[model samples]
Target: MAAAKIKKGDRVIVLSGKDKGRTGDVIQSLPKDGKVVVDGINVHARHTKPSQGDPQGGIKRSPAPMPVSKVAHVTADGKATRVRFEIRDGKKVRIAVKTGEVING
Candidate 1:
């Protein structure tokens, strides 16, 4: 397994699709699927019928998992940047390829 380039809580920009150019924080990471769910991104609507558990069942909108390749890490300048691993002070850290800065985990 390889290190995760994108992880939960990281801000990212969508690279393609209807939500392209939009930025959001990573809500969940699915390494097995190579996908990530970003808050307010790739929202999908699901219509549901009323069930006994709930009095009213209506349309639900939620962020859907998108391929990790569709998103890139956002730099402090708000530009999308690729992530790279580097060892500094004997600790492996993620580096922003654009600005050569350390990314906060």
Candidate 2:
């Protein structure tokens, strides 16, 4: 994978599509596919028959994976920003392009 910038648990803002301008936490990351599933973003409804655990499994909404490029990292102040890597204190760390803040993925 080509250095996945967004990791699970990071807050991100949608850059385009239906969820543009909305922010959510990254729930899952598919490094190989270069996609990320964010909470409350790209959700779609699915119909399923009643099951043991979910008796009313009807019209369940779940998040779908989106291209990693579609989302931008959110800074501590809640602004969307691009990420870059830099060597800091003998360790490679991600820095926010807008704020120059160190991001902990």
Model number with the top lDDT: 1
Tell me the tens digit of each residue's lDDT in model 2 across 2-104.
6879999999999999989999999999999899999999999999999999998788899999999999999888889999999999999999999998998
TM-score, per-candidate, Cα-based = 0.97, 0.92
Candidate 1: lDDT of 68? 100
Error of 2 at 34 (Å): 0.8
Report the C-alpha lDDT of model 1 over 1-105, residue by residue, as the tens digit.
898999999999999999999999999999989999999999999998899986699998999999999999999889999999999999999999989999998
- Kindly report which residue stretches of model 1 are placed more than 4 angstroms away from their true locations once superposed: none
Whole-model Cα lDDT of every candidate shown, in order: 0.97, 0.93
TM-score for predicted model 2 compared with the true structure: 0.92
- Per-residue lDDT of 31 in model 1: 94
What candidate 2 gets wrong by more than 4 Å, as runs, is none
Top model number, TM-score: 1
